[model samples]
Target chain A: MLPLCISHGDLVKLFVIALLATTALAVASLFVGVSEISFFALLSGESNEKMLLVLGESRIPRTAALILAGAGMAVAGTIMQLLSRNRFVEPSTAGTVESASLGMLAVLLLAPDLPVMMKMLVAALFALAGTALFLGILRRVPLRSPVLVPLVGLMLGGVINACTTFFAYRYDLMQAMGAWTSGDFSAVLRGRYEVLWLALALTAAAYFAADRFTVAGMGKDFSTNLGLDYRKVVALGLLIVSMVTASVVVTAGILPFIGLIVPNLVSMAMGDRLRHTLPWVALSGAVLVLLCDTIGRVINAPYEIPVGSMLGIIGSIFFLSMLLRRRSRAA
Target chain B: MIEFSGVTKVYGSTTVVDDVTAQLPKGGITSIIGPNGAGKSTLLSMIARLIPCDRGTVLVDGLDVARTSGETLARRLSILRQDNHMTARLTVHDLVAFGRYPYSRGRITADDQAHIGRALGYLGLNDLGDRFLDELSGGQRQRAFVAMVLCQDTDYMLFDEPLNNLDIRHAVGMMKLLGNAARDFGKTVVVVLHDVNFASCYSNHIIVMRDGKLFLQGSPREIIRSETLEQTYGCPFEVQELGGNRIAVYYT
Candidate 1:
């Protein structure tokens, strides 16, 4: 009735395109490695014992981890944007991942013998609390420009990271905390990488919460007028966001800017149809992280750069370019 | 029928709407006219549940507005505030389509589409449906907001300063639209307006407010007199008969 632009046909076409692009990036991620496993020898698997281990255990899981982490972060960003009614909010931008990292560090320091799920639960609780605190501050401090909200969020995140760093340094646990926050994919082997599948489950929960979030963005009165319990929607959104952040933190440390960058690009292209944008944001996010991970591996041939470091450098440059373009247009 | 029983809203030490009790009858154009800081908008917001009353309750067709769920009241009543600023980049069609959200929740059905098309046609916005709200003039945007309220298709419609940015022609068109909605569609229309001439000309029932109290309520013929207008607005107003309508001339 409203001109079904993304009908079944258009949906199939866009998804197929997204799937093909992501698959290409995934294959590139596997073969383009920094180790001594040349492509010819890895394919043959005939004379190289160490190459098999790198190919089977390391490359495959890392690529899978990249895709999983990217999709989870992008979906989480979309939900946060819808919930807060701000386009620039992402898990990392809003201090969600940093808070979760702090929680994980606490678990490592305090309860090192706890189960992996328990540690993740603690991290999720901290991430949710952090997001709630940020939103509360947003309500109290009225921002004139949309740009100021994200900048405020970034400063808040910096504060949280500063606190985490100070404690980690004091206790001589800086090395452990550093590894978790820098996002190294080299450790995402078979046994350690199952936590990322939880993100796939969170993606489904995100779809269920998208409609409620859209209504909630219309203002508290309007959402209540539409029969949506605003507090419940906000809580559900925070829970999904926190869980996604915790899983990504526990699995691959911190992947910067995927949550912030990918969703903005998808919204620009596809409009803010959550039903339509969710899948595309996920696929594009996976592709971007995979591409970035591959580039990081190829750029420094022997000793690889961390994906988080590479994303920080490249993503910030791209984000700054976008900001300049927007400023020029406004001028 | 909508009833407000001793609905008093107090802001801090100040009472904005003080002990206001009134019953607005069904199926007529009722206009509330008052001076600045008379608590007209505050009263309207309390009735629409946009602002909660501290002391009393409002009932819309016998359903307690405060106790009933917002969605339930939303089906029977709709309100358009003075400011309708949107953060999203939306076309006129997109803005109007949100009127159907109470029913379709953004998934537009055939019935919803029909209502949207009709509202657009009624408001003479068929051509401007695809244009952005920012691209239109202020009067056109006002008309678009009114069209959204009409598309909502509720039994009770409330508007606060609906003609704030309209020129003379568009203002008359808006008053005529509200009048027609009340007369033809059997809907109760309540508007808060500063223009006494428009209220005198179009409204069947009129209420005058002063200093956060309902000072007078009656037919336009009873309340649109020179003395009442003078006392309510604290300005000189000459009530003159113009083309079988009571016209309050206060432009001096």
Candidate 2:
């Protein structure tokens, strides 16, 4: 193994570089769309009301939602990985997103008149319960191999997704379920995406508690030896992960892989100290989502591909390569 | 002083530690030695409050370990388990800095920094402080853990099989380090040792366990006799005195 430790100065420098890249991507995402919103026209003060309306309503909110969801999901993934002590475990694989989808479906069928905020809360509660169940199952399984954890999570996710699909088909709400499950930011208006701001707050809270999560990652014995209440920290971590998953799923649908890929890549390079690597993870996640969303918009100019499909294709490749690489190295 | 009266631990109908009641004197090195499945580690863990006792009371300086707050017990005692597997990728310095968590709570103060530096130097890990733990040798990693325990600066320190994957030189060095800590700092050092010879040579007091019970407790001179060793280990043993230390030589 190479020397994986980097100085604090290098970490800060890396963070700056990542921030700049995310900013550039965010700026680029603002301009790429079906409508022609040129930078010069906006800056020239020509008073293009229609273009201003498009920028404010569609472009800005979409970009903001992309950034918030990206950062929040990635931070949530980091916390989940630490709490579970397994690198492969994330919200998407751990049945959190599927549970949130189920909650959204329930709300749509039972109380269609409820506000979007209430829907998000319902989804968050369901997500929390589902994640707790996943943890309970994990505790029962003999964790002799690291791969067993994510396998159990993926199996749980598959079961929940199957139930969700069956319910959608039975209730004849398949189209609505499709809209909730596919991650597309095209319909994100100004008022529609404010729920994602809660994800932003949760992400910040995760950062503030990063040190505790890092200590908790060392395992229960280490935490107790250090005088920390391990159970409380793990509970807070699970709550943050569920809420972030629910908010993102509610706002723009399920963005897979951002939670799994971003944190793994960041920790591979920067070590697992959350206080140092979390900002990098957040920035990388935002950059990935913004770039993919931009590509999805540009590839089929008039007809946009959903960002969820785009991320699914990209994230699966990363996931496969990571698994293969780990296996080959172990062998 | 650490006192445990009627401390017991049972796992699935088997009493791992059966009514172990003893008093460990402060300010010296005490070694607990026994055969496999004798519950040496379990007793140490109960004293450190790592695992809850099935039924008993453990008092560290008169504060009940089961009732006292973890933070308060942490300030008074520290324990290092045998298997220290962690998912986090931490450098030697980062791992040792966690020792100050009881006082600083993850924020490294100037005093904590001083303690960390001294621990690194004491363990001869000054140059390896920046190295990741997985990149180091087994002996170096063991020393790093000991360095962390030393940096904790507690009055009492408990180690479970501290010499588990080390070479002879490193094992001797670890025992010397523990001896130095007890002599220089007046700290109470308790260790679970597998090698009875090592226990006989270094420890000021010795505890012997068998079949989940305390079989004997005495100084090295009293416990290193041939008949006592045979009774405890159920093997033939020859004891010889060399350089004022009783060495046990067992027949195969």
Candidate 3:
């Protein structure tokens, strides 16, 4: 036998290192926004209320939102990959993110005064419906190659995005809707971003069922043979992905490739066992998004580039390299 | 005992396995042998609920495979299919440990651990237990899967083409091991095999399938005759008694 080389202690040590890094980045994020907080002035009790207010209300909430959004989306991506039996798929690929944005648009158009919680619910329901439609289409397509499933998902997402955009343009709500669809942390005030804790709750639920998800990832026959209700597990997985997507979309819009990139990175280091690798996925996700959002804030100083656009650039390059690696490995 | 009643599988206009109704005997190694498109694998799959039959039912120990709760049925029956593809970087030990998921739900108890150990030992895979499945040779990988099915510890075990990549020695070892598992444990083993002579040697009962139908089923001695062999294969086959075993010679 292999003698259990990577012990539990090693994993604990790895987690501790990741945790310390994320904490440092979060601390740095609190200090880097548009407002300049003079620590020396505050310590001398000069009574700069504006710096304290910005630090308390804006930066703290933005940092927390970034961590929650990043971790939740990354965990969601891992679950989506497992349920679909494909590595290239994510919440965005499944059309769930666009569907959630569509739901947000519908609520904004119809009941503009709806509470934040209600908006989240509406968007989550739409996300669930959208993911169901994507999965239904996926079922019909022959899964002969590893690349086909993700391609179908991207096409499904594209169709949904097109429909949503068309409606937004016609109603002249495109400007307002566009802000909610692009991921940026600038507007994340304390009261505005608390809804993302629900995404964290969804993360917990996924963790509880992590082993089942791991088994389910091995394809239907294997999971069914292991006595898993494959359909039910998959449905639960979709629901989790939809809620996490909806929560992030409502709070920070879509942070494009954190989910896709985070899980793959974690898997490269930790292997594919969902239970063991999920914490690493969440940690890496939180770290990656936090670091990127901080850089986005500082890159323009007073003005900010959207975190989603930043991730788009980083995520695509990472994704392309992964694809190349797989091709070369296969060859 | 597994009872297949009027089992049929149709794809588009053609039937893959058409109306196979028979009882697989309990507590012995039964081999289903046939040509490439003879529905042998399909029929075995239907019995294990791996494939839903189009027009009939499969009963294992009086519980209909299609309608029974998967958890309950899983405890009684287990199946190993031919193509075992996975994306995980699992060692042989890790893969075998998952065989206990039906019972332990990923929480391997001491008893489950014991079963895993025994299965590895039974397959003589203990030495290779720590190696990743991708690192192992094809024959070793094949044995690892067989070990997993055995570790499932179900009373009724079914395998679809378990000897695909095995060399001659391992193939013979596999047949004898399966035969011993059946005889020693009072287990029912249903295997689909392409080699007729191996079937004649190890199988307590032989079933020949041709063109989606059951062509012949009997003891090795009765089913190993030249007439039955020729009819099943659609070619001339010579049967000879060698070392007190019935052997079928079909090659040029």
lDDT digits (tens) for residues B155-239 of candidate 1: 9999999998999988888899899999999999999999888888999898888889999999999999999888898888899
| TM-score for chain A as predicted in candidate 3 | 0.95
**Which of candidates 1 and 3 reaches a greater lDDT?**
3
lDDT (C-alpha) at residue A198 in model 3 = 95
Rank order by lDDT, top first?
A: 2, 3, 1
- Of 1 and 2, the candidate ranking higher by TM-score: 2
TM-score between model 3 and native: 0.95
Runs in model 2 lying further than 4 Å from the true structure: A1-6
Best by TM-score: 2
CAPRI tier for the interface of model 1: acceptable
What do the candidate models score in CA lDDT, each in turn? 0.83, 0.90, 0.88
Worst 10 residues of 3 chain A by lDDT: A1-10
- Pairs with steric clashes in candidate 3: none
TM of chain B vs. native, candidate 3 = 0.98
DockQ of 3: 0.57
Fnat of candidate 2: 0.65
- Expressed as tens digits, the lDDT of each residue in A1-331 for candidate 1 is 1233446687778689869878887877777766666766656756387777887888888999999888998888888887777777888889898899989888988999987778888999989888998999899999977778888889989999998999899989998898899887878887787788898889877876655665565566556555456788888889988998898898888888887788777766555656556788888788878877888788888668888998888778877876787678778
Worst 10 residues of 1 chain A by lDDT: A1-10
Query: TM per model?
Result: 0.90, 0.97, 0.95
Better of 2 and 3 by TM-score: 2
